[model samples]
Target: MPYDPPPELAGLSLAQIAEQVAARNLPPLDTWDPPETEHSGMRITADGRWFHRDSPITRPAMVRAFASLLRREDDGRYFLVTPHHKQAIDVEDAAFIAVDCKADGDALAFRLNTDELVLAGPHNPLRAQGDADTPAIYLSVRHGCEARLDRSTWLQLADIALADGGDLSVGSQGATFALRPA
Candidate 1:
Protein backbone atom coordinates (compact mmCIF):
# COMPACT_ATOMS: atom_id res chain seq x y z
CA MET A 1 0.00 0.00 0.00
CA PRO A 2 1.05 3.57 -0.59
CA TYR A 3 0.14 6.66 1.45
CA ASP A 4 -3.63 6.81 1.39
CA PRO A 5 -5.57 9.35 3.30
CA PRO A 6 -7.34 8.19 6.41
CA PRO A 7 -10.59 6.44 5.59
CA GLU A 8 -12.35 9.06 7.70
CA LEU A 9 -11.04 11.80 5.45
CA ALA A 10 -12.81 10.26 2.48
CA GLY A 11 -16.04 10.56 4.43
CA LEU A 12 -15.70 14.32 4.70
CA SER A 13 -17.74 16.62 2.47
CA LEU A 14 -16.14 18.19 -0.58
CA ALA A 15 -16.04 21.51 1.22
CA GLN A 16 -14.08 19.96 4.03
CA ILE A 17 -11.75 18.39 1.50
CA ALA A 18 -11.37 21.79 -0.11
CA GLU A 19 -10.30 23.27 3.19
CA GLN A 20 -7.72 20.53 3.62
CA VAL A 21 -6.49 21.06 0.09
CA ALA A 22 -6.24 24.74 0.74
CA ALA A 23 -4.30 24.07 3.90
CA ARG A 24 -2.00 21.86 1.76
CA ASN A 25 -1.84 19.00 4.24
CA LEU A 26 -3.62 16.30 2.34
CA PRO A 27 -1.95 13.08 1.16
CA PRO A 28 1.16 13.58 -0.91
CA LEU A 29 -0.07 12.46 -4.29
CA ASP A 30 3.18 13.00 -6.19
CA THR A 31 5.02 10.89 -3.71
CA TRP A 32 2.57 7.99 -3.86
CA ASP A 33 3.88 5.10 -6.00
CA PRO A 34 0.79 3.04 -6.39
CA PRO A 35 0.60 0.29 -8.95
CA GLU A 36 -1.17 1.06 -12.19
CA THR A 37 -4.72 -0.16 -12.34
CA GLU A 38 -7.11 -0.79 -15.19
CA HIS A 39 -8.62 2.15 -16.97
CA SER A 40 -11.48 3.61 -14.94
CA GLY A 41 -13.60 3.93 -18.10
CA MET A 42 -14.15 7.53 -17.16
CA ARG A 43 -13.83 10.50 -19.45
CA ILE A 44 -13.74 14.19 -18.77
CA THR A 45 -15.28 16.19 -21.57
CA ALA A 46 -13.97 19.44 -22.95
CA ASP A 47 -16.50 21.35 -20.91
CA GLY A 48 -15.38 19.68 -17.70
CA ARG A 49 -18.23 17.22 -17.48
CA TRP A 50 -17.27 13.76 -16.26
CA PHE A 51 -18.77 10.56 -17.52
CA HIS A 52 -18.45 7.00 -16.30
CA ARG A 53 -19.61 4.16 -18.54
CA ASP A 54 -21.12 6.78 -20.86
CA SER A 55 -23.29 8.12 -18.03
CA PRO A 56 -22.73 11.51 -16.48
CA ILE A 57 -21.54 11.60 -12.91
CA THR A 58 -24.28 13.65 -11.24
CA ARG A 59 -22.66 14.26 -7.90
CA PRO A 60 -20.70 17.48 -7.61
CA ALA A 61 -18.62 16.27 -4.70
CA MET A 62 -17.68 13.08 -6.45
CA VAL A 63 -16.51 15.04 -9.44
CA ARG A 64 -14.50 17.39 -7.27
CA ALA A 65 -12.87 14.58 -5.38
CA PHE A 66 -11.86 12.85 -8.60
CA ALA A 67 -10.61 16.10 -10.04
CA SER A 68 -8.40 16.58 -7.01
CA LEU A 69 -6.71 13.29 -7.69
CA LEU A 70 -6.15 13.86 -11.38
CA ARG A 71 -2.63 13.76 -12.72
CA ARG A 72 -1.09 13.93 -16.18
CA GLU A 73 2.12 12.19 -17.11
CA ASP A 74 4.75 13.41 -19.56
CA ASP A 75 3.77 10.49 -21.78
CA GLY A 76 0.32 12.11 -22.18
CA ARG A 77 -1.62 9.81 -19.92
CA TYR A 78 -4.19 11.03 -17.45
CA PHE A 79 -4.80 9.18 -14.23
CA LEU A 80 -6.95 9.51 -11.16
CA VAL A 81 -4.35 8.43 -8.68
CA THR A 82 -4.70 7.35 -5.09
CA PRO A 83 -2.32 5.66 -2.73
CA HIS A 84 -3.82 2.33 -3.58
CA HIS A 85 -4.52 2.78 -7.26
CA LYS A 86 -3.53 4.76 -10.34
CA GLN A 87 -6.52 4.41 -12.61
CA ALA A 88 -6.26 5.75 -16.11
CA ILE A 89 -8.90 8.16 -17.33
CA ASP A 90 -9.62 9.67 -20.72
CA VAL A 91 -9.59 13.40 -21.28
CA GLU A 92 -11.33 14.76 -24.31
CA ASP A 93 -9.51 18.05 -24.73
CA ALA A 94 -8.66 18.89 -21.10
CA ALA A 95 -8.90 17.57 -17.60
CA PHE A 96 -10.25 20.79 -16.16
CA ILE A 97 -12.16 23.91 -17.28
CA ALA A 98 -11.42 27.49 -16.44
CA VAL A 99 -14.74 29.21 -16.14
CA ASP A 100 -14.09 32.48 -14.39
CA CYS A 101 -11.23 34.86 -13.76
CA LYS A 102 -10.17 38.01 -11.92
CA ALA A 103 -7.41 40.45 -12.63
CA ASP A 104 -5.91 42.09 -9.60
CA GLY A 105 -3.67 44.70 -11.17
CA ASP A 106 -1.50 42.73 -13.60
CA ALA A 107 -1.90 39.40 -11.88
CA LEU A 108 -4.66 37.11 -13.10
CA ALA A 109 -6.45 34.30 -11.29
CA PHE A 110 -8.77 31.81 -12.99
CA ARG A 111 -11.45 29.72 -11.32
CA LEU A 112 -11.65 26.23 -12.74
CA ASN A 113 -14.72 24.03 -12.82
CA THR A 114 -12.96 21.81 -10.32
CA ASP A 115 -13.11 24.74 -7.86
CA GLU A 116 -9.34 24.98 -8.07
CA LEU A 117 -7.47 28.20 -8.64
CA VAL A 118 -4.88 28.70 -11.43
CA LEU A 119 -2.81 31.81 -11.51
CA ALA A 120 -1.83 32.82 -15.02
CA GLY A 121 1.78 33.46 -16.14
CA PRO A 122 5.25 32.12 -15.57
CA HIS A 123 4.87 28.64 -14.08
CA ASN A 124 1.22 28.67 -15.11
CA PRO A 125 1.63 30.21 -18.54
CA LEU A 126 -1.54 30.57 -20.59
CA ARG A 127 -1.45 29.25 -24.16
CA ALA A 128 -3.73 28.74 -27.14
CA GLN A 129 -4.50 25.84 -29.42
CA GLY A 130 -6.37 25.55 -32.73
CA ASP A 131 -6.32 28.57 -35.01
CA ALA A 132 -7.44 32.16 -35.42
CA ASP A 133 -10.99 31.22 -36.44
CA THR A 134 -11.42 28.94 -33.44
CA PRO A 135 -8.91 29.40 -30.71
CA ALA A 136 -8.81 26.90 -27.89
CA ILE A 137 -7.20 28.41 -24.87
CA TYR A 138 -5.58 26.64 -21.95
CA LEU A 139 -3.87 27.52 -18.70
CA SER A 140 -1.30 25.23 -17.19
CA VAL A 141 -1.99 24.15 -13.65
CA ARG A 142 0.66 22.67 -11.42
CA HIS A 143 1.80 19.05 -11.53
CA GLY A 144 1.80 18.97 -15.34
CA CYS A 145 -1.98 19.46 -15.52
CA GLU A 146 -3.90 22.11 -17.44
CA ALA A 147 -7.36 23.66 -17.51
CA ARG A 148 -9.05 24.68 -20.73
CA LEU A 149 -10.51 28.15 -20.62
CA ASP A 150 -14.28 28.13 -21.13
CA ARG A 151 -15.91 30.60 -23.51
CA SER A 152 -16.88 33.15 -20.89
CA THR A 153 -13.45 33.09 -19.33
CA TRP A 154 -11.86 33.36 -22.74
CA LEU A 155 -13.98 36.39 -23.48
CA GLN A 156 -12.91 37.97 -20.22
CA LEU A 157 -9.31 37.38 -21.16
CA ALA A 158 -9.97 38.79 -24.60
CA ASP A 159 -11.45 41.90 -23.08
CA ILE A 160 -8.34 42.38 -21.07
CA ALA A 161 -6.28 41.78 -24.15
CA LEU A 162 -8.20 44.42 -26.09
CA ALA A 163 -7.76 46.90 -23.29
CA ASP A 164 -4.07 46.21 -23.17
CA GLY A 165 -3.17 46.92 -26.81
CA GLY A 166 -4.99 43.93 -28.23
CA ASP A 167 -3.00 41.48 -26.12
CA LEU A 168 -3.44 39.48 -22.90
CA SER A 169 -0.02 40.14 -21.48
CA VAL A 170 -1.49 41.35 -18.20
CA GLY A 171 -2.59 39.08 -15.40
CA SER A 172 -2.73 38.61 -11.69
CA GLN A 173 0.66 38.54 -9.94
CA GLY A 174 2.07 40.25 -13.02
CA ALA A 175 1.48 37.33 -15.33
CA THR A 176 1.05 37.89 -19.05
CA PHE A 177 -0.73 35.95 -21.82
CA ALA A 178 -0.48 36.85 -25.46
CA LEU A 179 -3.66 36.35 -27.47
CA ARG A 180 -3.41 37.13 -31.13
CA PRO A 181 -6.40 38.54 -32.99
CA ALA A 182 -8.46 36.19 -35.09
Candidate 2:
Protein backbone atom coordinates (compact mmCIF):
# COMPACT_ATOMS: atom_id res chain seq x y z
CA MET A 1 0.00 0.00 0.00
CA PRO A 2 1.14 3.50 -0.76
CA TYR A 3 2.03 5.59 2.27
CA ASP A 4 -0.32 8.45 2.93
CA PRO A 5 0.73 11.70 4.53
CA PRO A 6 -0.32 12.23 8.14
CA PRO A 7 -2.95 14.86 8.75
CA GLU A 8 -0.40 17.17 10.43
CA LEU A 9 1.74 17.19 7.31
CA ALA A 10 -1.04 17.68 4.80
CA GLY A 11 -0.65 21.43 4.40
CA LEU A 12 3.09 21.75 4.97
CA SER A 13 5.31 23.20 2.24
CA LEU A 14 8.08 21.25 0.54
CA ALA A 15 10.66 23.27 2.48
CA GLN A 16 8.85 22.52 5.74
CA ILE A 17 8.76 18.84 4.94
CA ALA A 18 12.44 18.89 4.16
CA GLU A 19 13.22 20.78 7.33
CA GLN A 20 11.28 18.33 9.48
CA VAL A 21 13.03 15.40 7.88
CA ALA A 22 16.46 16.93 8.39
CA ALA A 23 15.81 17.53 12.06
CA ARG A 24 14.26 14.09 12.69
CA ASN A 25 11.37 16.12 14.06
CA LEU A 26 8.57 14.63 12.05
CA PRO A 27 5.76 12.96 13.93
CA PRO A 28 6.59 9.42 14.94
CA LEU A 29 5.74 6.92 12.26
CA ASP A 30 3.69 3.82 13.01
CA THR A 31 6.88 1.77 12.64
CA TRP A 32 9.47 3.68 14.58
CA ASP A 33 12.14 1.64 16.33
CA PRO A 34 13.83 3.01 19.42
CA PRO A 35 17.61 3.36 19.39
CA GLU A 36 19.09 0.22 20.85
CA THR A 37 22.81 0.83 21.29
CA GLU A 38 25.24 2.78 23.46
CA HIS A 39 29.02 2.93 23.98
CA SER A 40 30.50 1.83 27.32
CA GLY A 41 34.21 2.34 26.87
CA MET A 42 37.09 2.30 24.37
CA ARG A 43 40.84 1.79 24.63
CA ILE A 44 43.68 2.72 22.26
CA THR A 45 47.39 2.12 22.69
CA ALA A 46 49.59 4.90 24.02
CA ASP A 47 52.13 4.45 21.25
CA GLY A 48 49.24 4.18 18.77
CA ARG A 49 49.47 0.43 18.47
CA TRP A 50 46.25 -1.58 18.11
CA PHE A 51 45.86 -4.96 19.82
CA HIS A 52 43.15 -7.37 20.92
CA ARG A 53 42.37 -8.21 24.52
CA ASP A 54 39.85 -10.20 26.55
CA SER A 55 39.78 -8.14 29.76
CA PRO A 56 39.69 -4.51 30.90
CA ILE A 57 42.86 -2.88 29.54
CA THR A 58 44.19 0.61 30.12
CA ARG A 59 46.01 3.22 28.02
CA PRO A 60 46.62 6.72 29.49
CA ALA A 61 47.71 8.87 26.56
CA MET A 62 44.85 8.33 24.17
CA VAL A 63 42.77 11.46 24.67
CA ARG A 64 39.24 12.11 23.46
CA ALA A 65 39.17 15.01 21.03
CA PHE A 66 37.07 17.85 22.46
CA ALA A 67 35.37 18.92 19.26
CA SER A 68 32.99 16.63 17.46
CA LEU A 69 34.03 15.20 14.10
CA LEU A 70 31.66 15.64 11.23
CA ARG A 71 31.98 14.15 7.77
CA ARG A 72 29.46 15.33 5.23
CA GLU A 73 28.74 13.23 2.16
CA ASP A 74 27.25 14.22 -1.15
CA ASP A 75 24.42 11.71 -0.74
CA GLY A 76 22.45 12.41 2.42
CA ARG A 77 24.15 10.90 5.48
CA TYR A 78 26.17 12.78 8.06
CA PHE A 79 29.10 11.22 9.95
CA LEU A 80 29.68 12.82 13.35
CA VAL A 81 31.97 11.99 16.27
CA THR A 82 31.81 13.64 19.65
CA PRO A 83 33.49 13.14 23.02
CA HIS A 84 30.77 11.32 24.94
CA HIS A 85 32.75 9.41 27.50
CA LYS A 86 33.56 10.65 30.98
CA GLN A 87 37.04 9.23 31.11
CA ALA A 88 39.25 8.23 28.21
CA ILE A 89 40.83 4.85 28.83
CA ASP A 90 44.46 4.35 27.83
CA VAL A 91 45.42 1.51 25.54
CA GLU A 92 48.73 -0.30 25.51
CA ASP A 93 49.57 -3.61 23.88
CA ALA A 94 46.77 -6.15 23.38
CA ALA A 95 44.18 -5.08 25.95
CA PHE A 96 40.39 -5.10 26.27
CA ILE A 97 37.86 -2.41 27.16
CA ALA A 98 34.12 -2.35 27.50
CA VAL A 99 31.42 -0.49 25.49
CA ASP A 100 27.73 -0.24 26.31
CA CYS A 101 24.92 0.18 23.81
CA LYS A 102 21.17 0.15 24.37
CA ALA A 103 19.28 -2.87 23.15
CA ASP A 104 15.55 -3.42 23.69
CA GLY A 105 15.65 -0.73 26.42
CA ASP A 106 18.35 -2.40 28.50
CA ALA A 107 22.07 -1.69 28.26
CA LEU A 108 23.82 -4.10 25.90
CA ALA A 109 27.51 -3.94 26.66
CA PHE A 110 30.68 -5.39 25.14
CA ARG A 111 34.41 -5.46 25.62
CA LEU A 112 36.56 -4.49 22.62
CA ASN A 113 40.29 -4.40 22.56
CA THR A 114 43.08 -4.72 20.01
CA ASP A 115 41.65 -7.64 18.07
CA GLU A 116 38.26 -8.55 19.52
CA LEU A 117 34.82 -7.04 18.99
CA VAL A 118 32.38 -8.14 21.70
CA LEU A 119 28.73 -7.32 21.27
CA ALA A 120 26.38 -7.78 24.24
CA GLY A 121 22.67 -7.72 23.60
CA PRO A 122 19.87 -7.51 26.14
CA HIS A 123 18.04 -10.43 24.60
CA ASN A 124 20.88 -12.93 24.87
CA PRO A 125 23.53 -13.81 27.43
CA LEU A 126 25.93 -15.28 24.88
CA ARG A 127 27.91 -12.38 23.49
CA ALA A 128 27.81 -11.78 19.74
CA GLN A 129 31.41 -11.18 18.75
CA GLY A 130 33.72 -10.09 15.95
CA ASP A 131 37.22 -8.71 15.44
CA ALA A 132 38.36 -5.13 15.03
CA ASP A 133 41.38 -6.18 12.93
CA THR A 134 42.29 -2.48 13.04
CA PRO A 135 41.42 0.25 15.48
CA ALA A 136 38.47 2.40 14.48
CA ILE A 137 38.86 6.12 15.21
CA TYR A 138 36.26 8.92 15.15
CA LEU A 139 36.38 12.20 13.20
CA SER A 140 33.95 15.10 12.87
CA VAL A 141 33.26 17.98 10.46
CA ARG A 142 31.42 21.30 10.49
CA HIS A 143 27.64 21.56 10.35
CA GLY A 144 27.93 23.51 7.11
CA CYS A 145 29.14 20.35 5.40
CA GLU A 146 25.81 18.64 6.02
CA ALA A 147 24.76 19.60 2.51
CA ARG A 148 27.22 17.16 0.98
CA LEU A 149 26.29 13.81 2.55
CA ASP A 150 24.81 11.29 0.13
CA ARG A 151 25.51 7.69 -0.94
CA SER A 152 28.21 8.65 -3.42
CA THR A 153 29.73 11.10 -0.98
CA TRP A 154 29.83 8.54 1.83
CA LEU A 155 31.47 6.02 -0.51
CA GLN A 156 34.07 8.62 -1.35
CA LEU A 157 34.77 9.24 2.32
CA ALA A 158 35.04 5.53 2.95
CA ASP A 159 37.41 5.18 0.03
CA ILE A 160 39.60 8.02 1.25
CA ALA A 161 39.68 6.81 4.86
CA LEU A 162 40.40 3.23 3.77
CA ALA A 163 43.10 4.38 1.39
CA ASP A 164 44.67 6.21 4.31
CA GLY A 165 44.89 2.88 6.14
CA GLY A 166 41.73 3.43 8.20
CA ASP A 167 38.35 1.71 8.12
CA LEU A 168 34.98 3.22 8.99
CA SER A 169 33.66 2.12 12.39
CA VAL A 170 30.27 0.39 12.29
CA GLY A 171 28.36 2.19 15.08
CA SER A 172 26.76 5.63 15.34
CA GLN A 173 29.80 7.13 17.07
CA GLY A 174 31.94 6.19 14.11
CA ALA A 175 29.47 7.79 11.72
CA THR A 176 27.08 10.24 13.43
CA PHE A 177 26.49 13.00 10.92
CA ALA A 178 22.97 13.86 9.75
CA LEU A 179 21.91 13.87 6.09
CA ARG A 180 21.09 17.31 4.63
CA PRO A 181 21.54 17.11 0.89
CA ALA A 182 21.01 20.20 -1.17
In model 2, the Cα lDDT at residue 181 comes to 18
lDDT string, candidate 1, 102-168, tens digits? 6645566677776665567687888877888888888888667899888888898788777877645
Best by TM-score: 1
Candidate 1 lowest-lDDT run of ten: 1-10
Candidate 2 stretches with Cα past 4 Å from truth are 1-22, 31-151, 167-182
Q: Where does candidate 1 stray beyond 4 Å?
A: 1-26
Model 2, residue 173: displacement in angstroms?
1.2
Q: What's each prediction's clash count?
A: 6, 38
C-alpha lDDT values of all predictions: 0.75, 0.28
